[model samples]
Target: MSTTTTAPGTVPAAGTTPGAAQGPPKSRRSRRPGLIPTVVLLAGAGYCLLPVAWVLIASTKSSRELFSTFTFLPGTGFTRNVADLSAYRDGVYWQWMLNSLFYAGVGALLSTAVSALSGYALAKYRFRGRESIFNILLTGVLMPPVILAIPQYLLMAKAGLADSYTSVLLPSILSPYGIYLARIYAAAAVPDDVVEAARMDGAREWGIFTRIALPMMLPGLVTVFLFQFVAVWNNFLLPYIMLGDDEKFPVTLGLYTLLQQGASAPALYTLVITGALLAIVPLIALFLVIQRFWSLDLLSGAVKS
Candidate 1:
């Protein structure tokens, strides 16, 4: 038997060609495309967060320090700013906060309820003109709220509801987008056989909906509520047009009024910044509280054998 001696650098692997240039694996190379999305996401996040950071830092500054200091630096006037804001107009800022809470909370709840009913009906029922109705709602969704603000104000004026909380609340309660979301969610989240079984057990339509369907739809409803709450909370034009009385103004309009006044009285600028900072707290809190509900998968046990 003859023995073959291989040179030190000339040994080939089992299948690879000898003297082939070794390179990184294909998987690592594929990950290079992900960097673009990551860069885009970081840029987007920075764009969104930069204003919030400026607001937070600016709120801490006194009027004199606000312009003198660096834009991102924190100052020592947050407490004083709060005090001045509270003292303004006998604490009307708190009233605006409460009005905003009422409008957002009540309007979101009512909108979610209406969306739930409308969505469930649209998903499960085979009524005449149902698609047409949903298409109309889609059209409403496409129509900007700014466009409707004038007509809504006029309607409220004709009905003697202008300048009242009811005007804001009523218009906010019927959200076409909310209804559309609910319809899509219901069709996906709910199983048709479950409804048939409930009906076979002699359950009334309302009972079946409340007891069975509602629980399954809770996550979607929460989303609708959150969206409507944020929309109503941040609304300006509708309230600005509908309300002449500053007393009924939601925080958004109230802040705008403050901003307008700040042009004349620069001291109110600090208050406006402080109020703007405070305005976002409830929304943050609400998102924190509501996020846990979204994790629940309620449909898992609905059709167990």
Candidate 2:
């Protein structure tokens, strides 16, 4: 048979010619979505969410029903439980709620503001001791809360601020972790050219910071605020050591107090559980509310040109 020659640069059909250079192999089509990651994620979700579900159901239960009924079973004592909580120790639970709100809300807001300002300064300004200061702050982050707590308490006592609202609120105001996050965000999100341009245009430093930098750093600030909020809200040891008065207690300490008494007075167990459920509602709601404002893209910042 006579042979026919192909074009020199002709690619073999399906690119399968022996000894030919090949592109990356085509990925195989999966018949279904990945099962292992899905299973793992679902397992993790269930593990976290199951306790929340238990609490919700348990809170609805009457004391007797709580012990007798299946854990997941619903009960009808939710209103009564709320009433008992309200009536307990002259409605002290609500005071704890308010105190928690103040500590977390005010503390987070102040911390975010300070972190934003400090982060921006560190990121944009050329100053002596910048790296040293940053390193010190970072070191603070590594230091355990336990290490600082007693010293903080002692200092508060010296200043006569201990066992007061200032004792709890003041210590939480400057968060090294928040500063670290803010510094990273500021560096990533704020461009040097923009800062220079603002300066050249005769904008004052504060003006540039408040008007130009703040908007760019807003997303990161919101993240900082949320993190600090959760931290302050969940903080137990600081408030526990600082405030001796029950009236000044945050919800965390209040819950701890209830839990302590719960060992002897088992009836307080339901109240503790109920209060815990209530405590987390604000966090969840804050998350949902903040979700609308948080932009992942902005936080990631512009890709390198």
Candidate 3:
């Protein structure tokens, strides 16, 4: 074989170059989502939205139109339906709405206060039996609400408080999950050094908590408050088990009783549909209104400082 000498620093041809026998560079391939994932997500959204869509359409139909027409079609009796609902039993529906508001608003406020206090202490202080206390409270989360309702009703009865609004309101003010959420929020949001600094400045424990800690925990407390509000609003079993008087009924129980009566009176069916539509309106409006201010990051125990 004849040797070929090249100029200094000159590149040789591909086949002639030593150690240049590797394969070509691989190009990146497009990654398209598999068909099943897209379909499942779409299906889940459709499933959740189905009832809401039906309720909207059903509210518009007259008693006759509701049974006569297809489920999705709109009818001409929307205004008449609302008027009829308003006229029913001298507008007892509005009373139920007010009761629901009172329960949610007052109960949520109290629950948030309790949760904030307990959570702040639990997170910031190292006390004896802290783990035990937390574990006991967490056990409440596992207990079914139905299981608690019976005993709560019995206790309220023994206290002569049953069949009263207090029977409903009192039980809702202490939520274990709310406390848990508050603890997580406190641990994540309030810095220990900040608290130490406040203490060194001769601030009382309560003063430091009220002025400094509470403002930082506000975002988390708001979440706890909203959760409690919705829980009280949507609650049916507790109120149903505790209160017998229709006058004291919350909207959930009232609407349910109305639906039960629909089996005998189809006319009430229309009222039930209309009431159901109205019952969810405030909650939807509340979510829309507060969603703008709600800091969801606090829910997961993360804050931007």
lDDT of 1 by residue, 69-112 (tens): 57676999999999999999999999999999999999999999
lDDT tens per residue, model 3, 29-135: 33345666889999999999999899899999998999886768888888999999899899989999999999999999999999999999999999899999999
Candidates sorted by TM-score, best first? 1, 2, 3
lDDT, candidate 2, residue 146? 84
Each model's C-alpha lDDT?
0.92, 0.91, 0.91
Q: Which candidate is the best by lDDT?
A: 1
TM-scores, all candidates, are: 0.90, 0.88, 0.87
Pairs with backbone N, CA or C atoms under 3 Å apart (clashes), candidate 2: none
Tens-digit lDDT track of model 2 for 75-120:
9999999889989999999999999999999999999999999999
lDDT of 3 at 36: 66
* Candidate achieving the largest TM-score: 1
Which regions of candidate 2 deviate over 4 angstroms? Answer: 1-33, 295-305
| Candidates in order: C-alpha RMSD to true structure | 4.6, 4.3, 5.1
